[model samples]
Target chain A: MSERVSRTTFYKRLSRLWRNGDSRPLLMQALVVLVVLLLVVWVINNTMNNLEHRGISTGFDFLSQEAGFGIIQTLVEYDESHSYGRTFTVGVLNTLLVSSLGIAFATVLGFLVGIARLSANWLLARAASVFIETFRNIPLLLQIFFWYFAVLAALPHPRRSLAFGDMIFLNLRGLYLPQPVIEQGLMPVLASVVVAIVTALVVRATIRQHRLRTGQGTIAMPWLLLGVLVGMPALVWHFSGATLSVELPQLRGFNFRGGITIIPELGALLLALTIYTAAFIAEVVRAGIESVPKGQKEAAAALGLKPGKVMTLVVIPQAMKVIIPPLTNQYLNLAKNSSLATAIGYPDLVSVFAGTTLNQTGQAVEVIAMTMAVYLTISLSVSLLMNIYNRRVALIER
Target chain B: MSDQMIPARKPPKQSVGLLVWSKNNLFASLPSTVATVLIVYGLYLLLPPVVQWGLLDATWWGSDGTACTTEGACWAFVTARLDQFIYGFYPQDHQWRANVFFFQLVLLIGWLTIKATPGKKWVLGYALLLMPLVSWWLLYGGLGLKIVATHQWGGLMLTLLLALCGMVASLPFGILLALGRRSNMPVIRALSTAYIEMWRGVPLITVLFMASVMLPLFVPEQVVFDKLLRALIGIVMFQAAYMAEVVRGGLQAIPKGQFEAFGSLGLSYWQGMVLIILPQAMKLVIPGVVNTFIALFKDTSLVLVIGLFDLLAIVQAGLNDPAWLGFAVEGYLFAGFVFWAFCYGMSKYSQRLEQQLHQGR
Candidate 1:
């Protein structure tokens, strides 16, 4: 193996590797690599020179330094005394909170509107199209401003909030909801809830196996599920003796206190992100549904399935194969758009970490790189999961 | 029986009459009926108030917000600052230059978008070469014209410029990236894939932040970029990743046979891509390309984060003025409407183009 080939044979092997001398892709690739390496080095050298020129020390050490700034909508335990690392965690949590909430609401609303657009009823379909067109065309930033400054800011102050049966209140400050308080012994209840879920899943899987193997439906399946899912949790709560109370926010001095508050920054960001993204999701869903052949629906109907059953069983499963890829894209988009929360002081990753921390520390390279890395991880991970799903569902050819 | 003359008597009342149509469509079932009623009620609540606020009670001629206030939108504010929103601080005398450039662009776009227009080759050359020169001369005003600095350009003018430049500049680079991603060379392929993914993974805001703040550090100390140019660079780089994907879709749809055919015709890879493969692939991807352009156009609003006063930022600037402090709603609505109109119009054209191309294929 260590022996070298003869010169004539070596040249012959090289000619074969070069694809009969058509062109030199290897040469081209080498050139590209050299250019890229040179570019990266030049950039680094210039950056070092500039950093020295500006007297700005750069490192990730700034992340451990005192943040000394406050974020209005932190999800984690945080204060002015926390480190920039904690601020980063808080910003990530807030971004995830808004993104997950937006995803949930947009999925529900988008599906409904998508179905409405397909409805036989002319009015509903027209209304759905109008909803899509109006929201889809407007810039999200403008919509964010409209919701934050125009609508929410115009609400009355805490002293004269629009009370909702006195259990909820809307004011310029934010939406105040009744907070559910559970004091002591909640661990048992939570454990029972998890147990109930596990038991339900086990029962379902067993029933499905029995039916598949023995070819018989379990008549008491619904009752068994209900008993496990509902009865178990209720019994655990009774035995645990946990006390629960609902506390409505009350006006304290000039501001409201003691309830779960959804600040207007979050409200506006969530609303804009949800509404804007839902429009795209609606289009994706509509296209997905339309992609299902009409013959499938007709064939299912001919087999005596009702329209609803036909849709649920036959159309939806097929439509999902079309929907998941674009739906994943929209999810990625919403996550990225959550950064727009910076516009309204929503304390997202970009706003708190990149905007505020970078300003204070003047570690532009580190701060911005960290921010981009977080988003990149999110987008790449989601797309990777979607790729696996796509591969699983892709049509297999002979 | 064969003639079936009885069928011609009249279609059943269940299918033919207006009442039947309404019953079938508007009151088809319980949920639909409820939806119809709720929707009508919603329209009743929303439409009249919207019309009344927008038109009936709006103050259209006032010079300031304090003039002739009513319980409706102050269109007067928009009208008073309309020129500012359109021209920004571009010198009042030099405003005609901006107008001429806009008209030239409008003509170019119409020529490109209209179906089967003649002189396509000439239009391509003009768009590729001449228009950029004319625009720079007309807007930047250095050739026998008074120089208008970039900061003086803002509002809708800057918005269009950013979108157009981003679209034009990224397109060829996007094509190259797409080709490189599909290249047989492993190193080039890996590098292109990494470059595309790196941009696509991050949000545009981060890209803009890096461009505006950290970009100067990556260049020599003597070099400086105007804020608008930095923002444009960010937009182009961010947009190219998406554009590459679209073009890749087009390229992928071209079968391997075409590549083999080009090769058999004694064409090198670059020659084949440029002379044969690209034209056909580009035709397939027009609508997809247009869709990305709409995205880039809407994304132009993001420049405001970097302190560039594009259309939305101009409105924001106006709203910040002491005289117009309370008209955030009016300012945002106007800016929203303008953005919506452009986006909606482009999207509709793209959709129609897709249908037309699909039918042709």
Candidate 2:
């Protein structure tokens, strides 16, 4: 085939290309792309050269050094002596704590408000509208400040803290609540939970198998609960002492000394974020609920299902498909907005890594890079989780 | 039966006009009647104090903080510090030049926005060139105006400058980013994704911190960048990612027919995008664009975190003035009202634009 190839054939193709008259546009396009590419390369090269001249070493090496900063709220034990990597973990955990709490609280409030917005009761609908408008219109940072400086700061001193029963205390600092202490015998209770879960799984499988094989099935929930509550607890109690204690918070010299103290900074940040995000989430929830056809509710009712069950099983399940994507957006928003915590001295990820670290180390490039990486990782993980849920809820068909 | 049917008539009216309307709308049921009563009473309780504080008890004209000691809004503090708030530490006499610069900028912007104006392209080009030059002269005062450095820039002037500059700089960058995201080439798409996600994932405060602190360290040891310029850069970079995503949503909503028609018409992608697709997409996204603008306006308040005195910062600074001590609530309320007005107007305008566009469609 190579031997048979002729100069005329190649020339014909080349001539045909010129004759086709598409070359001019193609050349223009190519030139435009080339110029743009050259400009980008020039900029990048200049930046790199600038960095080199300045003696600024760029990379991930600084992550191994001592952080030299204290985080306020940490899940894992941490101190100023910890490595930057560990400090970063602390920051990440604090971020997760706020976002998760915000998500849970926002979802509950959002659903209530959203349903209220669509309620037949005029007062309920107006109240929901008022809540959405008032909260959503104000800037979240301002709300955080309001909560921190105005509301929380106005609370009485610890000695005269607002008493919420015998187990909890409230002051300018935050809500202080009792912490439960698990005793040695609690192992049996935990073991029972594990047994219960396993038994439930086994029962579920058996019921499905029986339904398929012989059109017969038994409710497995009671048996599973009995197995866990009776079997595991009895076995564990015989082996060890089982006891429990609750330590109630009490006002001391200037602050609560025992139990868990939710600092005002955390409270303010969480409250602002949850309330602000809940407004948007309420709109999302309202839209989701309204998107469900009336016929579905009617059909459920026709099947002899109670109104509450109809909502729990049929309406919510379908509405969730609509709810989840926007809910994910709101989740991301809450996470990002939590950075406002820095304004009030909540030592979140941004405050610790981006704010304090940059101040101390003066390694702006590396510290900023590290901060961005942390946020990016969190955002991506949240997106990934939501996407998986989205896939599961999506309709499947041949 | 026919006589009975003929005798059937409308029910007698028990009420008329507002009474009937109120009965139907405000007091439709027992609970609604209670809500109506409570709401009216609540309004009566809340509004009079607000009116008194804002208007009746306010000090309108004063030279200093001494004029605002009463249990009312410290308008005199705002008026006395108005210059400080508007131009920050910028020189006093040169403020007139800034005012002139602002008026000219507004005139030019108005010219561009008005459809009847000819030479749209040339006016746009001039605007693109003149804004930076005039603002530089107005702010830095190098070209015969009087050089006032960025440190002196604060208050409404600072806010307006940041919003305008950030919005303008972000537009082109965001458009490119959006195009890159939608590009057919995998490498280009990946690069765009990385850039957008990196910026979008983090909060603007982090970015600002980087700009103010890390950026100098990244460049060189002794090379100093202007703090205001750095903040502006941070604002632009952070906002561009969000703007790109918004633009991308609009881009995606354009139907395949539009693309195919452009293709069949032998139009290049850039040509089609610029001349046809973008206009339609942008019109469709007017509400989203306006919402983003409102968001950007609110976000300008965050500049306080980095020590720049925007409106909120100025109010915060006012709270510390010995005469106005313990007036944080009043200061914040004033600032909040101003912000609310601007944002509310933008939102309302967007809603109107949505209706306008819908009708046009």
**Which ten residues in a row are the worst by lDDT in model 1 chain A?**
A389-398
Q: What does candidate 2 score in Cα RMSD to the true structure?
A: 5.8
What is each candidate's DockQ, to 2 decimals?
0.85, 0.30
lDDT of 2: 0.79
Across B182-239, the per-residue lDDT of candidate 1 in tens digits comes to: 9888898898899899999998888999999999899998898988889888998988
Segments in model 1 whose C-alpha atoms lie over 4 Å from true places: A1-23, A218-223, A395-398, B1-8
- Per-residue lDDT for A1-398 in model 1, tens only? 43455777888877786775545677567778899999999999999999988899977887788999888987778999999999889989999999999999999999989988999999999999989999999888889989998899999988999999988999999999999887677878888999999999988998988888898996247788988899998998997787778888998898889889999999999999999999999999999999999999999999999988898889999899899899989999999999989988999999999999889989899888889999999998988898888787874411
Could you give candidate 2's per-residue lDDT for residues B1-361 as a string of tens digits? 4655466766658566766767777788786777678867887999999999888887777766676767777677666776776677767877886687678767885786566989977887666556766676667776565677787778777777787778767877888999889987566677687789888888888888877865664454446788888898899999989889989998998998999899899997889999889888877876886788778887888888989888778777877788756556666666667677767766777788778878986
Candidate 1 has an interface RMSD (Å) of 0.8
Error of 2 at A200 (Å): 6.0
- lDDT by residue (A1-398, candidate 2, tens digit) is 76458777887786776556566445444655688688777655655676677576667676788887777788899998998777777777888898899989998998888987886556568978988877776778877877787678888988888897878888877889899987766976787667766876777778778877887765344666567557766776666667779988876677787898899999988899989889899999999998989999999999999998899889997888899898888888888888888888887888777777766665566777777787788788888888787776664411
